[model samples]
Target: MAAARESLLDAAGAALARRPWPAVRMVEVAAAAGVSRQTLYNEFGGKDGLARALVRRAADGYLAGVERALAGNGGDWERLTAVAEWTAAAAQEDALVRALLTGCWSERLPAPPRGPAPVPAQRRPEPPLPSPPDLVRIVRDRAVTALSGPGTAPAATVELARSCELVVRLALSCVTAPPGEGGIAGLIRTAAPRTAL
Candidate 1:
């Protein structure tokens, strides 16, 4: 079942890369994955559900990369600076990451209408897709933990965490709108960890 789900998500992702989300049909995704339409619907519920799952998968991958960046060698500042540089490069190279960072998608078509049939008054609206800020918070929390790891005094942990948050915010800002020549490196260098007051 998990393999089936993965296969469908992979197919859906491929479709997304080639065209807008609205044009991606579940039947086509099923056909692409060699799964039945029922299997696709059973796994993802609907197009909205599939979209959420796709975004979640991408977000998870991005966060995993962040974990690697935070765990890389050198002091906190150096690791964070590396991550900032990485984020900038990734935003330019990957459309999904760019969409996650910028909350704007060049390839995403307009979302389809709620449903073909009218909704019941008692039925709740579908859950909203995870917001871009949610992704930021996940990265920030991980960074705080990474920044505060070993050798960090308990007293300084809070301030160090705040620094991590700032670093993440700045990196995200760079992703949203790339800096001018030499500007990104300067941003990262300036964000380097300082002694917590």
Candidate 2:
């Protein structure tokens, strides 16, 4: 079953690569996968479900790449550089990642507006939007893993993790940004504090 699900996802991704998300019909995906429409629906409820799964799968690949880069020999700076470089490259190479970053797919198939149409609500509006990408949490988790070991200094470990996070986020932003913008190295110098040096 898992293999079948993965096969469906692979089919979806390949289709997406060839055309815009809006043009990608379930029937086409089913045909490409040699599965019935019902089977596609069973695995992924609809287009939105399939898109979400694609994004999640891409994210998993990115995180794995970062982990592999970190595992190689280097100090914090070198490892951070590796993570940044790998992430940028991955984002560039990944169709789904580009789709999410640019909202190319989501914009093509936007969700319907919430609340009653042509009716104003009396209740207070919802809270402000959340920040992008939850960098703090990702950084903290990576830092803990990288710094926790025998003979590792607590302060240095924290610093290294902080540096890594800064570099990684910077790289992500650059690779994901619209064309004509500069790369991650520019963002790194600006975001990382002097104390982090």
Best model per TM-score: 1
User: What overall lDDT, based on C-alpha atoms, would model 2 receive against the true structure?
Assistant: 0.62
lDDT of residue 16 for candidate 1: 85
* Cα displacement (Å) at residue 141, model 2: 2.5
Prediction-by-prediction clash tally = 0, 0
Q: TM-score of each candidate?
A: 0.78, 0.70
Give the alpha-carbon lDDT of every model: 0.72, 0.62
Highest-scoring model, lDDT: 1
Candidate 2 ranges with C-alpha deviation above 4 Å: 99-131, 176-197
lDDT of 2 by residue, 1-197 (tens): 57767888888888877777788899888888888887777776667666656666775676677687767797655566677777678767985554433334454432322332221133233322112354335544664576456776889667766766666666756675622434454455567653543
Clashing residue pairs for model 2: none
